[model samples]
Target: MDFTSLSLAYPWEQLPYALFAIILAFTIHEFAHAYVAYKFGDPTAYQQGRVTLNPVAHLDLFGFILIILAGIGWAKPVPVNRYYFKNPRLAGVLVSLAGPLSNLLLAFLCFPLLLLADQFGLGYKGIIELLFMIIKINIVLFIFNLIPLPPLDGYRIIEDLVSNRTRAKMSQYEQYGIFIFLLIFLIPPLNKLLLGPLFQYLVPAIYRALDTFWSLFL
Candidate 1:
């Protein structure tokens, strides 16, 4: 999920592809959240137009810039009212998971196009690059959103799973969640310790599985 390489190694010409990928990935991620929340009886996001696929509805200015510059950022979070759900805990977890899962779905959908581009040596190199960029950004979004920390889908899932008392304790420290998240990425040792294995192993494994599955068809 580390995009440091994209920023440093890729030329300025590729920025448009990266930006397109980011908009699509982030839009789908947030839309999944809003749609799921709406399905589970929360109209909050829907009423606010957060359920739309339009990137403008989901993109946050600062977050979008950070994603382009640093490769780590977020979209406008879909608003949800858990009180509207009959089973708040379960619904909450599902709603929280929707965003990351949507990104994974996007990555899965893009894999075959990427494979075809490679297999046929597509003359339009830009198209191939765009597909690759889309896949990479979506996969990164999937993995990064699932890290169990505040302001992330994983943390929301955890918050739903825990008891009320534990959740209350978590709430007390919610203000520091963003700081902690930044520390994990900003501190090299911490980033290596927490996300190294995930990016190194899990991401590759996912691609391998996708390749194996798609190879049968292509």
Candidate 2:
């Protein structure tokens, strides 16, 4: 969960870019949830003003502080009343998928800008660095939130897919899920197992794909 694990060298110098990227990523992510839920006949989040782009509506104070200090954080979850949906299971899955997919979309949109900056040698190192950070952070958010564990969008998707009895069994251990999530990162072997493929293979592969695709135009 540490941003430093993303190999962001010069932590202090990159802090501003990281903060900006985090805010954008978290805001768009949460807004997507709210928007999709509203469209699916759940106005719960929209009624609470969660559908807006304002970061204030989405940023959780403690999570924001944790992210600033420790590089791990989260936003306030958008409230959705599944009872309003005609198909609660399908709507729930889409609502959960919305947040992570928004992040991936952000990364996809930003990749071209990063490529353009590199192609033109913009000379504005700060701008180039900011774009890079945005792309990287959004990609990280997209992948991280999709990990099938409790408190993540992936788990919500799973909950929607599973039978009621299975979901009830999952709920029995829901309270301890966050603790287990943290333990995975805190334990060295587990951390390596989780992050190794993500950083070594998936991330680089994504970047290469983006590069190849964007190189066609830029």
TM-score list, all predictions:
0.90, 0.90
The local distance difference test score of each candidate is 0.88, 0.87
Model 2: lDDT equals 0.87
Give per-model CA RMSD.
3.8, 3.8
- Model 1 lDDT, residue 86, Cα: 96
Off by over 4 Å in 1: 1-10
Q: After superposition, how far is residue 119 of candidate 1 from its true place, in Å?
A: 2.8
Which ten contiguous residues of candidate 1 have the minimum total lDDT? 2-11
By summed lDDT, which 10 consecutive residues of candidate 2 come out lowest? 1-10
**lDDT digits (tens) for residues 130-151 of candidate 1:** 9878887788788888888888
Error (Å) of candidate 2 at residue 91 is 0.6
